[model samples]
Target: MKRILIILQKEFIQIFRNKTILPIIFVLPIVQLLILANAATQEMKSIRLAIVDSDHSPESRSLINAFSHSKFYTHIPVEGGVNVSIEQIDFGKADAVILIPKGFGEYLIEGTPVNVQLMLNAINITSAALTHSYTSGIIQNFASSIGMETINVTSSKPSIRHWYNPELNYKLYMVPGILVVLVTIVGMFLTAINIVREKELGTIEQVNVTPIKPYQFIVGKLVPFWIIALIELSFGLIIAKIVFNLTIVGSIPLLFGFAALYLIVALGLGLILSTSASNQQQVMFMVFFFMIVFLMLSGLFTPTESMPQWAVLFNKINPLYYFMKVNRMLILKGSEFSNLWDSFVAISIIALLTIFVAIKRYHKSV
Candidate 1:
């Protein structure tokens, strides 16, 4: 225990002495949190829409107004007909084109079926799909407002409510996930390069000849980073609350408790990589490769349930997946430990496995 504390003190001294590492430890995560939370979003705010109104009637005008007034769309006026609007899309001037047919108002007044043509640029399938859904909802709302019985469905209406995120703010969903990613990067990458850096500096040989055991050495290496990562998580949460107005519905202590365990999984993975790697460069490349794979499979950007059956099965070994899911559950949903016992158990198992592997692989020799 005394040897471990001494090594921990030495590691802290070394970390603080490095000017470059200080910025990476403290500054970089903050910058990444701010940028990624805002930029990496699925929500589209400025969808350019071209309108072709052949009818020029009050009803047609009202329908056009609905889209124009929406916050999601930017109206692009075309001089000619539907073909001209298509040209606008071809020229990259518009994302979608809405054509109000010549007898749209007449059909609506006569209680007959009216057809409004909506053409979207399918270059980006996801964006196109969202635009289609948004436009369809607007058209339906417009029809209902003007009392178009033919367009109105059966009288039964579904009471739709968004539970966790009532306003559907993208940042609310993204910030917690981004926080997990930031913490993972710090814990994993720093620990991965720790022993390798010592090896490079001719310090590992000196330490290997000392009386320190492998477990003590590993604990010494792991604890400093574990503490630093928790501090990073705290600062990240504060930034999320201040910049994005993120509300934590769960216990802060619970979030930190899970974070403490999750950091072990990450730090142990790093230590395992460090033990196997001959140099810092090799460890960095390995860390980068695993980081990308873990992030993709972790359900950070997309739903894990939507992944292939093989991917879902493989994600069982992914530490990021467990923590990402748990972080959001605790922070956004206010879930108790009882609700997240399975994830906690999975992370605990992974932490133990990684520590065991790291210890076994580390050789106490020059």
Candidate 2:
């Protein structure tokens, strides 16, 4: 215990002494949190729409007016009709084109079915899909107002309510995931890099020759980073609350408790990487490779449910996936520990596996 504390003290001294690591530890995560929470969003706004109205009738004019009044669309005029609108789409000037064919007003007057063609630039699939949905909603609402029955509806209109996030603010969704990323980076990357750096400088040899056991050494290496990562999480949550106006619906102590266990999984993984790698470069590359895979599979931007069956199955082993789910559930939904027992058990198992591997992999050699 005393030896472990001494090593822990030594690790802290070394971390604080490094000039570059201080910025990475304290500054970079904060900057990324502030920038990414705002920048990384799925919300679509200001869609450029081109309307080709061949009819020149009041009904066509009203349809165009409906799109123009929407906050999501900006109407671009095409003088040469559908051909010009297609050209605009090809030139990247328009996201979607609404072709209001001739006799559109006549068909509506005759109470006949009228078809309005919608052409979308599918270069960006997500944008095109969102544009299609937005424009379709506007057209349906316009048709309803003009007493045009596009579809014979026997069912009542559904009362839609968005729970957890009533406003659907993207930041509220992104901040918790980003916070997990930052904490993971600190716990995993820093631990691996610091240990590999010691290996490069021949410091590990000196430590190995000492009276420290392998488990003690691994525990010593793990504790400092574990504490630092928790501190990082605390600071990140504070920033989330103050800057993003994020509200924590769950218990802060419960969040911290989960974070403490999650950090063990991350830090132990780092320890394993550090034990296997001989240099900082090797460990850094490994960290990057793992980080990319973990982030993609973690459902940070997209839900894991939307992924393929194979991906969903493989995500069971991903520690990030469990923590990401747990973080959002706790912070956004106010989920209790009882509600997250499976995640807790999964993370605990991963923590034990990683620590055991890290201890076994670290060789105490002169």
Candidate 3:
């Protein structure tokens, strides 16, 4: 008890006093939370759309008005006329082009099919998808409104519903996802390199030769990190609530429970890496490689369903994927344990595996 207490006090003092890391410990997560959360979003807004109103009639004006009124488009003027050449859309000068062919009003009055070309930039797949969805929605609504006003056709009214995020504000979806990233950084990167730093500085050897148990040493190192992580998480959540107006639909206690589980798994992963690494650089690189894979696989930026079947299967086993899912569920969907059994089960399994690996490696070292 005395040895563990002494080691804990030493670790705490080192952490609080370290000139290089103390500032990072206090500021890095907050900065990342503010910047990345704001930047990372599923919805693409303010798309630069080129207008080619060749018709120059009331009908074309109305169609253009529809886009302008919506939150999606920022209409850009064409040089020659409203109908910009194909070159304009192709060269990435425009995200989308609304081309109203000549005599569009004649076709509208005659009830004839008018070809309105919507050229979209497909290079940015996400922006393209949003553009397509927005354009399609606008056209669908226009057709329906026209049909309802002009001709009474006995057709069923389409009911549109959005899953997960109904309003699709973007920030609501990103806040929780960013929290997952902060957790990974604090638990894996910080702890992994810290352990290796002690090893490199010859401090670990001095401690290792003492009467302290390996578990005691590991726990003493881990506890301070865990406390610091909790503090960071609190600050993150508070910021999320204030700046982003993020919603926590699930129980706060439940979120903390899952966070605790995730922290255990993360610490174990860090310990495994720390035990195996010969130096801090190696630990950092190894953990970074793993983190990249984990972040990409997590369904934060894109739908997990959109990934290739093999990648989807691989993501099922990814710990960060589960963490991301849990956070989204808690924040957006108000998901309970009953609503998230699959994610809970997967996270639990991963936590066990990491702990087992870490313990095995630690014992081997001792």
Q: Which candidate is the best by TM-score?
A: 1
Could you give candidate 1's per-residue lDDT for residues 1-366 as a string of tens digits? Answer: 999989989999989999898888888667988899889887767899998999999988988899889998999988998788999999999999988889888889999977777888999998886677677777777887887645532231332345897545778899999999999999999998988889888888888998889999999999999999999999899888888888899888988988999999999999888878889889999999999999999988999999999999989999999999999998899999899999889988988898899889888863
User: Pairs clashing in candidate 2?
Assistant: none
- Tens-digit lDDT track of model 3 for 267-318: 7789899998989889998999889888998887878888999989999778
Each model's total of backbone clashes: 0, 0, 3
Residue lDDT tens for model 2, 1-366: 998999989989988998888777788667988999889976678889998999999988998999889888888989986788999989999998888889888888898877788888998898776666666667777878988775221121332345898545678999999999999999999899888988999988888888789999888889999999999998898889999888899988988988998999999988888878888888999988988998999999888999999989889989999989999999999998899989989988988898888888888862
The CA-based lDDT of model 1 is what? 0.87
- Residue 149 error for model 3, in Å? 9.4
Better of 1 and 3 by TM-score: 1
Instruction: Score residue 29 of candidate 1 by CA lDDT.
Output: 68
Query: Candidate 2, which segments miss by more than 4 Å at Cα?
Result: 34-42, 52-66, 78-87, 99-117, 138-173, 249-251, 301-303, 306-309, 332-339
What is the TM-score of candidate 1? 0.85
What are the TM-scores, per candidate, against the unseen true structure? 0.85, 0.79, 0.81
TM-score computed on alpha carbons, candidate 3: 0.81
- All candidates: CA RMSD in angstroms? 3.6, 4.4, 4.3
